[model samples]
Target: MKIKKVKPYNQEEDKTKQLSRMFNTISSKYDQFNDIMSMGLARVWRKKAILSLKPYKHDTILDIAAGTADIGIKAFEYITPTQITGIDVSEKMLEIGKEKVAEAGLNDKISLKVEDVSKMNFADESFDAAITSFGIRNFDKLEESIREVHRVLKPKGKFVILEMSEPRMPIVKQGYLLYTHTLIPFAVKTFSNDPKAYKYLTKSMEAFPQGKEFIAILNQNGFNCLKYKTFFMGVCSLYVIEKYSS
Candidate 1:
């Protein structure tokens, strides 16, 4: 896929507006396209991320940017949290997620709300833990979102972020690059009418910082016990960081 210069809203100006526009535009086919592009490993990857959280039976968890409620749904399966709130900026996305949530008879246990990550309309120390999957790269003020993650969390709350990352080893990096930059985009384009959305995915992941660089940012954002474990040869990372009296 030839990279196009689609003018993105600077994260500094308005992240919610930018992401709301983009996510709502892509809502209808987002889940389907996700399954195809990731070759169904996305769910397994999320399951691993949620399992790392060590949620107790009495825990209350929030899944930020919880597109279609998949991460929350997976989390519920693993640890049976007391209450799970899934928030996102895209109403259309939330609608789709709600439908799935209803079908699973999880409307009582899981709540879906349209919300902005940089400014969650929740009281300080509102949740025991919070998680977001494949959504941070889209944040306009990535740093601010991290701080917000700190704010809503209880003093010792856990924060787990599951996101895409480029490979690190030279040979594996080249292989994954050619596949994502070329093959996957081509396949998604055939199934998706909005080639631009697929274009944005490739560009965003390529532009995102991950691994230790990302871990360092979390440490700076008032998080404690910051650590990460990689999957598929570091193609993605499950970051487990805690907020200690933050």
Candidate 2:
């Protein structure tokens, strides 16, 4: 299956470049906007994502698209990991993440960097576990990014992902469509200068392949033991997978 590209501003430029600019534009209010949009339930979603890690004392974790280090911070709190590295394409977002990391007094335990997932610099088997929350849909090349993630993880390394998904129940699906199409954009316009960014958010979430299709993609990219759980009647999905190495 071909991956559909969603540009932040509907610009003709590269999706990565557009996405970086979009995140930078909204980095300041990103957290607040998330709370408002999700009715403060996004935090619960992130907490669930972190719990899926099953971290060990010596675990070295890589948080892909680690916007503002929320997942990384939670990993430290829950897993008490030896070290956590978060990588994202948005420098401005990473800058905010650095401040949050310091404020949490976790600067010594966590590091955030500006790095593209599709072309990561990490060596093979660099991390014991990897995760991304609401980040996979923005990848310009989904398959390449997945392959890069597979390359950096150790044998049998765990991979956990949280992302928005279309609801399956008829009632929930109708409500979700109305929320994303009307309510979300209205909220974005009222609260943010980057309305296009949220527009892209809804568009991308709708276009993204979920459930079994997503599992198939992960299996094809060297990740195995794929499993997923749906939340809010499938409005969101949490995927737990592991790397397979010979």
Candidate 3:
């Protein structure tokens, strides 16, 4: 089945442009909104995603869609990567992320930039490992972005991704839907600068391919799936993929 393409707004702009504007609008409250939506489990999930790269060579890491540097900041707690380079399309988001990195005494360790994953300027084989947390669903050209990531990583380099997913268990699915569609929207409307952003986020999650379907995308883009695991009854998923050595 062909997956539906979702955009933050109903206008003529592409997903990348719309997403950048949407995130910039809500960048200040993005972390708080995440806390409310995940009930604080976002941190735990991010920790796990970063730790998944611990066994690999991660001296230099690329953090894709690194909004507010959450994954980049959390990496220091789980592993000893010498440097982390974060890229995002939203300048405001990266502005806030830079502040946080400085405050966390990571100013020298982490760097934030405004760049799109699909068109990175870095040379090939630039990183030992790469990671993205709750960000893949927003990729306008998923395959192109994945291919870029593959190109930037050294042979055998690991790429870890953490993303929200629809629950498959009957009971869990019902509860998940209720929380996402009803509670999340209500909360966003009540507290967010752009209420419609969460609506797009939820809709995108529903339309995104999951499980084996997503694994297939990785495999086709020069990545070999090493592990796939779900958290909280499949509300979230973690993917660990490696670049083919050859």
Candidate 4:
């Protein structure tokens, strides 16, 4: 079966541009919204993902699609990397991220830039580790973006991703669908001016490949030692993989 492309805005603009505009519209309220919607479970998921990179220290880490820099800031808590570089298409998101970095007294360790993942600006093999949180589903060219991430990661570099997934348990699946299709959209409508953005988020999650299928995509993109774990009865997951050295 052919997969349909899931995009925000559903306009002529590409997914990247639409995502930027959508994120910028909610950048200021992003963190608060997350807390309310997830009931603080998102932080737990992020902490687990960051722990996967704890064994590496003094390495340069890339936080791709690092909206608001939450993942990057959390990275600092688990590992003392020499430098943390964050890139996102949303300039406003990066702006808020910069402020958070400085407020945390991590300005010296972290930097934020506006960059597209499908065509990243970093030189090949520039980063020792990379992490992205809930960001891959927004990529217009999923495989192509993974290839770019692989290109910049050093040999044996770790790439960890935290993203939403569907629950496998039958009852959980029903509840999950209800929360996403109705409750999430309603919450977005109440809390955010751009409810369509959250609606697109739910749609994108539904369209994205998960579990073993997603691992196959990573392997095909030159990632090795791929492993994944699910949380909240598979409502979310963490994929930990590495770049092939040889």
Candidate 5:
């Protein structure tokens, strides 16, 4: 598949817009790059994230930055409320997601839209659960996105997240840096033309606050039940949180 070329990211739009533009440009080859870089472990990581949340039948789930709707598609099995909405800020991403939803014969069940995670267009308490798989770290105002998520969710709503992290173990962390920062970019350059996107991805993950710091951010955002589950020996993690009821 050919990756679309997006204009250079403008620093003027804030960090979130720049990141969204980067992902939107590379949307076509996203699944491929993710699978190749993770050695197909990304899918397993996503499954672990989904399992962290306990949803009843037909729950209203809002998946943020849901590129091509992978999590939304997988979450279908638990959609007792019939289906869920997957929203992203990228029009190109939503287009691809919509196609996938139709191909899965879940067009009626799952809906896709282009909306910013930091400022949602939904009503209060509109959803029962929400998730952003490896997506929130790109938010310009990560706290704003978390609180935005909180506002749209009903009391006690589940919030699940799968994110990349720098390993805490001294040796493991160095190995991770070598692989993600160096080898991953090499692989992307070889397999895809837009190598800068991969380069940016590496830098962004490195800049993100992971593990305990991230959990602290969640807590600050009013999220309880903070559980950070490590996978692939801590190369990545899934954070599950909940907003308590009054």
Candidate 6:
């Protein structure tokens, strides 16, 4: 399937570059905006995503698109990961994340780097587990990024993804659409310096493949869907997939 590419500025630059710029632009207020936009549900969702990794060997975890290092920081609360290596394209975002990690005295346990997932420098089977939260949709090369995750993960290692998706039900879908299309943009404009970033974010969420479609993509990229769960009327989804042993 040919997914429509949604860029923040809709410019000639590639999505990765545009996304890096967009996140960097909004890095300061990104966490604040998330809290207001999701009404604190994002915290619950992040905890759930992290807790799902408990059954696996997640000692050395790789966090993809680890913006603000939320997932890495929170992983400490739910699981006993020895180390978490977070990679993101936005340097500014990582800077803030580093500050948070330092303040939490987690500087030694978590490391944040400015690296693209599609072209990571990690070796084969470098991590015991890999995870991403609300970040896969922005991949400029989604397939390649998935493939990279597969390559870096140990055999049968888990790769969990937490992402936003449109609700499937009738009444819930109506309310979700209203909230995303109306209130989300309004909130961004009122609170963020880069309103266009959230505009691109909503557009990307709409265009990106979700649910079964996303499972199919993962299957083709050397992963097997282990568990699929939707929260809050499918507004967000958690996909737990494992690398093929063979």
- Model 1: worst 10 consecutive residues (lDDT sum): 1-10
- The regions of model 2 sitting more than 4 angstroms off are 55-58
Model 5 regions lying over 4 Å from their true place: 1-10, 55-58, 78-81
Assess every candidate by TM-score.
0.91, 0.96, 0.98, 0.96, 0.91, 0.98
Q: How high a TM-score does candidate 6 get? A: 0.98
lDDT of 2 by residue, 71-98 (tens): 9987777665789999999999999999
Per-residue CA lDDT of candidate 1, range 32-138, in tens? 88888888889889988888887422288889889889987777788768889999988989998999988888889899998788888999989989888998887
What would the per-residue lDDT of candidate 3 be over residues 48-135, giving only the tens digit for each residue? Answer: 9999999999999999999999888889988999999999999999999999998899999999999999999999999999999989
- lDDT by residue (64-107, candidate 6, tens digit) is 99999999999998899999999999999999999999988999
Error of 3 at 138 (Å): 0.2
Scored by lDDT, model 3 comes in at 0.93
What order do you get sorting by TM-score, best first? 6, 3, 2, 4, 1, 5
RMSD value for candidate 1: 3.6
Any idea what lDDT model 1 has? 0.81
Q: Is candidate 3 or candidate 5 better by TM-score?
A: 3
What is the Cα-based lDDT of residue 100 in candidate 2? 95
As a TM-score, model 2 comes out at 0.96
> Which pairs clash in model 4?
none
